[model samples]
Target: MTFKSLLGGAALSFALALPVLAEENPAIEQRQGQFKLYVHNFGVMGGMAQGRMEYDADMAQTAADNLFHLTRHDQSRLWPEGTDSMSVDGTRASPAIWDDLDDFVTKFAALQDAAEGLQAVAGDGLDAMRAGFGPVGQACQACHESYRDEAS
Candidate 1:
């Protein structure tokens, strides 16, 4: 092939690879930010649920309900149809998530269950509410240990 044609082909190939090469996309950034926000809210709600800080029953229940709703919504959107080659802050979500999709789904489903249970029990009373909070905290830690950035 002519040198000019070869150069043109090479340029085209490079351009095609640009998206992957950048390792950053606005959509990914936005999603990552949303996930971080979810984590923060979860932590805050969990703290209240655990009685780490003083919080009224109504406030605790509201937080728990919000956390449960957001977690389910975010998980559905983030894991849609299985994804690979998506990482935020160096979290290489293990391939098992897609390979063993059923297992991942089960684990996340358990998390949802815990979150919902926490919400249901949140306004019951402080001691009973704290009892319910344990599982929800465990669920977050379980997913994070497996799927998220440990450093973060």
Candidate 2:
């Protein structure tokens, strides 16, 4: 195969591998892994916004883009039934997540929207990023308050 064909095959393989569903216990771990990625990227933006980290437009844009991608990622398998904190150890997902999945998904969609907004403005300037920051944080807080168990 040509070099470009090889690279295309690899990319296609990766894309096809992304959607396999996990079993219940493994689903918890999968979702946790996904959340860790979200936290890591979001923390970069948060640090910049709070002045805890120096603002770099390229880094901010990359982080915002990663967060946007993550927020839009399909994680239905990662949230399989019986994966909540009450059923699974080492998780902070409340059973309420399953009880009212539609509302939970609505809240997630709101976060996705907020992340898109951040992605659009994150590299514009500190002022622009700061303006976009609050909505993302609020969306996260709203979902966590309703769906996630408090950290011990």
Candidate 3:
């Protein structure tokens, strides 16, 4: 392999190993994993919406349900205090989250509401998917704008 590729591989390996190497908090890892799960399901619906992937009814419904399902969990354990971006090495959770958790939860409730709407129309058609996904996307953006790191 070329030197650039070799170096790139090493960099990737190091990035993937960052939590273990840094001895970071487990709550950070858990919450990050939960967000990754959100991305995985949301990416599927987003791909269909963007025409990057062929729209399939079953996949759309499943992805929408899974995304909404994530919203139903308690999620308290994943967000322990001292795990904000200011205090943690690898987290992107903003300090603002702890500043007013009730408001933060209200934002999350908006996501839940929007995701439920998306799940309702997920299998209807691409146009419906587009319409439904817009609110869900907006909900996520609203929360991220307030409580997520730009780099995250």
Model 2 off-target regions past 4 Å? 1-24
Collision count for each candidate, in order: 0, 0, 0
RMSD to true structure for each model, in Å: 4.2, 11.6, 10.6
RMSD of 2: 11.6
lDDT of each: 0.67, 0.86, 0.87
**Which residue pairs in candidate 1 have backbone atoms (N, alpha carbon, C) closer than 3 angstroms, thus clashing?**
none
- For residues 1-152, what per-residue lDDT tens digits would candidate 1 score against the true structure? 99999999999999756533113544444556656766776666667665687767887777778777866774455553323444333334554576677877777888889988988888887877787788977886786676553332
Candidate 1's C-alpha runs over 4 A off are 1-12, 15-23, 49-51, 74-77, 80-92
* Candidates 2 and 3, the one with greater lDDT: 3
Give the clash total for candidate 1: 0
Q: lDDT tens digits, residues 20-110, model 3?
A: 3113667677777788899999999999999999999899999999998998988998888777877666677899999989999999999
Give the worst 10-residue stretch by lDDT in candidate 1.
80-89
Poorest 10 consecutive residues by lDDT, candidate 2:
16-25
Clashes of 2: 0
TM-scores of all predicted structures = 0.69, 0.82, 0.82
Which candidate number has the best lDDT? 3
